[model samples]
Target chain A: MIKARITVTLKNGVLDPQGKAIEHALSGMGFDGVGQVRQGKVFDVELSESDKAKAEADLKAMCDRLLANTVIENYSVAIT
Target chain B: MKSAVVLLPGLNRDRDMIAALTKISGTPPLTVWQTDTEIPDVDLITIPGGFSFGDYLRCGAIAARMPVMRAVAEKAAKGVMVIGVCNGFQILVEAGLLPGALMRNTSLKFVCRQVKLQIANANTMFTRRYQPGQIIRSPVAHHDGNYFADAETLRRLEGEGQVVFRYAEGTNPNGSINDIAGIINGQGNVLGLMPHPENLIEAAHGGSDGRALFESALGIAA
Candidate 1:
């Protein structure tokens, strides 16, 4: 079995309203030292197949097919 | 005015969309699952609002790459009318069917309230039922409903009159660019918005302004 973790984030240069809002809120809360905030998602998957190469392929395919939006979001996978 | 409503695993508003469509068009729409390989032939396709895939990897990101979305995209290319509400709107943007992205609210909170929207472009399939510059009330409930695009893209959208709705005066609820609430694709066949029109279909459900959107699909002008 192979296990993998995936992280997804909005591409740079895209405005992150949530992060902006959090920055403002933090500032209002007196946490003035904070400079920037960005949010992301993480996914942990366990594959039953024993072939690491096949698992990586499947995982990448999943990311390309449905797990990530390459336009505004980027994704990376780490396998163990 | 037969329609098909796409249903993702975590979709919660599919029933509401079906009910609203039935009331306005008198024909219940077919529900297509995300994993389905084929999209049914219908006059319109609706991707209902919900936390699809638990909103795990960004709203609508996962659902955008679903098997059914590819078919939806193909149908959209053939000029099939498509409407995506809330999370579905995010999916459309993520899938490249529409421009811009729906970021989190500028307030960093899940905003749930009735917001006033001005019908910016009444020529599309969704807003044809509304009068030009008409003001209507609808509910917007989302955490990432802030819409963003590059300045050039925004200018083009404005020049092309692709913006369908904008937040009413003094109501930039999500801080979207120019207070945009909904937009249509360049072809004018596909639309994506953060508000939930289906939830406000009946008078008892706060208001009936949402009925016009469905009615427009049936060629009825409000």
Candidate 2:
């Protein structure tokens, strides 16, 4: 089995309100020098396919079709 | 005019949409389920507001991939009138039936309240019953109602007059870009908005400001 991780994140220009809230909370708790914080989502999947390239492509398709909203976010896949 | 309401798991507002359509059109709309690969003939198709698929991953993300949405998209492509309210709007965006995306509210909160709406464009099939630039009241209840579109898409939407509604005055509940509350597709047949026009369709719901939308879509004048 091949295990992969998909990371989905808001694009740079897209506003990250939840991340901003977290940043604010960190500052309130005295965490200094925290310039910015952006939020993202991660998904882990295990594929029975023995071919690493095929598994990677399938994971990318999954991200494109379901794991991410490409209108405002970007995604990347890593196989472990 | 005949109508139908799309249903999916975790959606709670299908009945309200049905009730509104039934009372307004004098006929009940058929309730279509998620697994149905085909939708019967209908003039207007409405996707009601609610947390479909438990809002997993993102509001409407999972539900947008269901067979029913594909059917909705097919019908929409054929120039049928489609209206998606709140979570329905999210689904439409997720399904790529509409442009842009809805994000977490700028306030990072679930806001449930009444908001004043301005009919941004009354020339479309859904707003012809109202005078241009009319101000109306509608209720909103959602956590991720903030609307966002990239610069080019925003320009196109405005240039094409696809923007149908805006939060009137200071009632921008979720900090949507340009105070946009609702928009129609380029073809002007699919409308996806975050307000609950169904909830305020009559006096018993506090006002009838939202009835003209149904009237216009149904081709029935008030």
Candidate 3:
């Protein structure tokens, strides 16, 4: 079995509304000096039976097929 | 009257959406799995709410890239009505079928409750049943329902009247700007909203305001 980790995030230049709201609220709470905040997602997958190379390929396929939106999101995978 | 609902692996409210469609359209809708490469022909395509792929790597992130979404996007471009609720809304946004993204609540807490929504734009196919400035109640359950957009994008949405539903006054549950509960694309074919209209199809569910959405779609086909 191979274990793989994936990360997904919104593409840069797209406004992150949630992040901005938090920034405002934090500033209101007197927490100034905060620079920037971008949010992303993490996924862990355990392949039933595959070598590292195959597992990485499968993970990338999953990202490309359904896990990440290539238009506005990017994904990366690490296998162990 | 053929309609279909896309079903992601972790979808939990598909049955509810199906039930709503059956009751409204007098037929059970077809279900298209995420792995399916083809989308069945239908007048409307609904992406039901659920933790698709366990909401991994972000809500709706995984499902947005699924094979079915590609088909959904293609169909949408041809002018099929696409409605996405909750996590489905996230998927639509992630798929770039709609502008903007749903982010975590500013409070960082999962919100689950009935929220009041104002019908901001009643001219769209998904909202023609509603009267302008009317208030309706729908249930919202999610951790990331905060809608985000750039200033220019927001202005454009407003100018084009693409903003469909806004959170009612004094009930901005998710802190969405202008209390936006739902929005439609410029073409007005695709609609995405955080609140679950599927959950409020019957009076027993505490309200039937959501029925209007289904009715509007049916009316369009009729």
Candidate 4:
């Protein structure tokens, strides 16, 4: 079994309102020197296939097809 | 004029859309369910608002992949008119039937109110009833109505006049880029917008600022 992790994040130049709100809230709570806060989604998927390369490719297709909105977001696949 | 409404589970605005199409077109629109793979011939196909699948994963993400959307895509490819409002807009974008993505509101809060909408391109069949540069009122209610696209795509949309509606003046409720409220597909038949034009089609619902849109799409004489 191969387990894969997918992280979907808003691409640079795309506005992140939720992330900005979180950043503001952290500052309101007195967290100092907080830089830009960006929000993203993570998915842990398991595949019965034992091939790491094939699993990674499948995960990427999953992101391209459903897991991420490629217009405004980018995703990374990590197999462990 | 014949029209149809796309129906999916957890959507609350199908009734409103049906009523609007019926009243405007003088014939009830066929309702295409999520599981249905076939949609009968119709002039306009509308996808209404409200949460679908509780908006899991992302707004319209799950619903966009349903069987009905495939049929919708097929119809759209054949040059049928398709309009998606609010969450409907999200679904169209998610389904890749339309350009750009509807992100969370800039305020991070659900916005439900009226905003002024300018007819960015009145030349399309959907907006022919409205005069060029005409401004009308539209009601928007959604948590994720902010639209985003790559700079290249944005440039093309603007250059091709695919942007059909823009928030007029300073009523940019969700911080959408270029204050875009509605857009049409590159082929010009499919439209996706955040505002609820169906909700304001009659006098009882207040001024009929949105009636012209339905009239145009339904081929009714204004």
Of the candidates shown, which would achieve the greatest TM-score relative to the real structure?
A: 2
Q: What is the DockQ for all candidates, taken in turn? A: 0.48, 0.92, 0.25, 0.86
Comparing 3 and 4 on TM-score, the stronger one:
4
lDDT for A35 (candidate 2)? 89
Summarize candidate 3's per-residue lDDT along B1-222 as a digit string, tens digits.
Answer: 689999988989899999999998998999888888888889999998889989876688878878899999999999999999998899999888999878767567788999899999888888888899999999999888878787788999999999999999887777676678899998899999999988888878887889999989877332
**How would the candidate models be sorted by lDDT, starting from the highest?**
2, 4, 1, 3
Model 3 bad stretches (over 4 Å): A1-80, B220-222
For all candidates, what are the clash counts? 0, 0, 6, 0
TM-score of chain B of 2: 0.99
- lDDT tens digits, residue span B1-222, model 1: 679999998988889888988888878889888889888788899999989999876798889888999999999999999999999999999888999878778777788899999999998888888999999999988888889887788999999999998999987788788999999999999999999888888879978988898888767655
| Candidate 3 docking classification | acceptable
- The C-alpha TM-scores of every prediction are 0.84, 0.99, 0.78, 0.98
Least accurate 10 contiguous residues by lDDT in model 3 chain B: B213-222
lDDT at position B38, candidate 2: 94
How does each model score on lDDT? Answer: 0.87, 0.95, 0.86, 0.93
Winner of 1 and 2 under lDDT: 2
Q: How much is B23 displaced in model 4, in angstroms?
A: 0.6
